[model samples]
Target: MISFDKFYSLFQKNLQNLYKNSKEIESIFFLLMTHIFKCDKTTILLKLSKKGKIHFIIYKKLIKKLWELKKNKPIQYVIGKAYFFDMEFIVNKNVFIPRQETEELVYWILQDNKNTKNSQIFDIGTGSGCISITLKKKKPKIGHIYAIDFSQKIIDIARKNAKLHNVKISFKKVNILNSDIPIQKKINNNSIIIIISNPPYIRISEKKLLHPNIIQYEPFQSLFVPDKDPLIFYKKISFWIKKKLTGIVYVYFEINQFIYLDIIKFLKKIGFFNIKIKKDFHGFFRMIRAVYYKKK
Candidate 1:
């Protein structure tokens, strides 16, 4: 058994050797203690004051997980869970980790639909079903929520997450680029339908600039687009919007910070009228909301 302070000091020193940023070191420490050890920050602090020692078995497990982190594996993947939209989600290498920017996308949708009744939501490329599941959890009045991803394995994980959150959602396996499956065929004319996606928008050319944890561990197909076609998923999903959306169709996307203008232009060309872009916490243009109201 090792004292809490001793354990923290040794673990942080190990992380510091891998990460130059102190904030990252501290954040990882906090995450590991809370998520892995099931001890909150305050609890850990209190334990430190009392010179509490962790069980040797738990300490050994921590050391093993840290070894994976040294290989640039994301801490979320190492722990097999992540927190998004104030809820815990099961995550693995098969899906993209739910991001903070994606939470902003969820926030915008929740705010827009705060007063809305009887709404149907479709999430394209719902990696972990975070967006759709979060919406259903937050706004229980939302009518059918459907999420799709190309990988059946990924859809299974998303479905599990929805179950974990105790939210009802439909998870489907469909490649959005080739899918013609109409979502929610029997919606009432007055019901608002929102479609949201946080598709792969990073350019392959910019791949090297991303942190090793993301590029090395997160699913490559979910993080990057070909340099020649950075907006491929956006364009394909936008075309789907043109096809299947019949009601007051509101579209939301978490986009690559660099190509938001391009996305805006594409939406305009595709006849989406009321389009808006939003910035994330770092003030990067990371989300866009557009509307296409069907002719009355």
Candidate 2:
């Protein structure tokens, strides 16, 4: 067992080798410290720059974990949870570590639905239930949220997250590839205001460009698509909703910035009008939104 200050000093060198960015190292350090000390990161970092001797045993395990991280494993998986959209979720190699961009997607939806009292929002491909849960937290008056995923295990994690947050959300394990979204559930169709997704837009050909953390650790089903047809999920999703949507139904997607025109064309073909492409905070075309309203 090593003392906290001693371990921190030793880990700092390993941190520099493990990550290109100091900030990521800092975050990982804080996350690990919280776990190791069995006290919150804030509590430990704020109160004791040094923890007493039992801390040495903790650092022994932590050093091994840090070695694993340098191999490109996600810290979220290492920590067994992820912070997304200001909420924490149980995460593992079983689920995609929720992305900061997806938080932008949820914030976009919430911003649009701010005036929406009793609005119903659908979070398709609702991995880990981050988007759906965040929506419910931000807009509790929302009539309902229908969240779905293809993986049962991932949905289990999502359900746990919803429970942890004490927010009610309808969850399903049906693969959208073989079946349409379940319309019979708590979807308040009349008030259905938004249909949002952060679907699998990554093309297999583009794999080389992805961060090693995503390529090596994240679930393939949740992160990728066939190179021949990268927009497969979006196309099928659009086809499924064409005849069903009414009211001011809006569809949003977190897009692959490389194929903006292809996505825009697909949106028009699917009958979504007034389509709007939006940039993430970093000014990348990371999201798209469009609306279709039935006749008055």
Candidate 3:
């Protein structure tokens, strides 16, 4: 067994090469301790004050995770879980980890439709089912929620997350880019329809701008788009709304900040008016919402 102070010192030293900030290293250390020991921060601090010792088996696990961290693996992936909207989600290499920006996107939807009843929500390119699951959990009055992804493996992970949240989301395996529309069930024409997506908007050329934790660990299919068509997924979703969906339709996207204007322009061209862009906490224009009203 190793004393907590000694183990923490070793942990800080191993993480220094990966994280330049001392506070970040300490934060990660506490996070690891709490996750591994299934205890809270106060308990961890109390143990530390008492000079608690870590069992040999737990020490070995921590060392292995430290090695992964040294490789610049995201702490979320290292722990196999991520927190989003105050909810824990199961994540793996097959699914893109949820981002705080995406949580803002979810909140935007909830704020707009809090009083809405019998609404159908579709989460296109749903990853880990974070957006749909959070919406379902927070807004139980929603009529139905559907989540779609191309990879069956990714869909499986999303299903697991939905199960963990104890929410019923209709998950489907369908490539948004494919010509065939995946949604086939008949819907009430008067019900509000909301479509939300955080699709692959990062251009292939921009891959170098991302960190190793993102480019090396996250699923490639969920992140990159061809440089020539950074808005492919958005375009596809727009066309789907135009061709397949009806009623008072509200569309939301977690957009690439660099292409916010371009996305707004495309949505306007596709007959979606009342478009709005929201800046995230980082002050980047990272989310958009638009509404389409059916002609009388």
**Model 2 over residues 99-197: C-alpha lDDT tens digits?**
888888888888887877776667888888888898898789866788889888888989999999999998887788899876753445457667888
Candidate 3 off by > 4 Å: none
Q: What digit string (tens of lDDT, one per residue) describes model 3 on residues 56-157? A: 998899899988988989888899899999899999889998998998998988899889888788899998999999998998887698899999999999
lDDT of 1: 0.85
How does each model score on lDDT? Answer: 0.85, 0.81, 0.88
Clashing pairs in 3: none
Candidate maximizing lDDT: 3
User: Residue by residue across 215-260, what tens digits does model 1's lDDT show?
Assistant: 8889998988998989999889878777766757888988998888
Worst 10 residues of 3 by lDDT: 179-188
Q: TM-score each candidate.
A: 0.95, 0.91, 0.96
Give candidate 2 regions above 4 Å deviation.
Answer: 46-54, 185-190
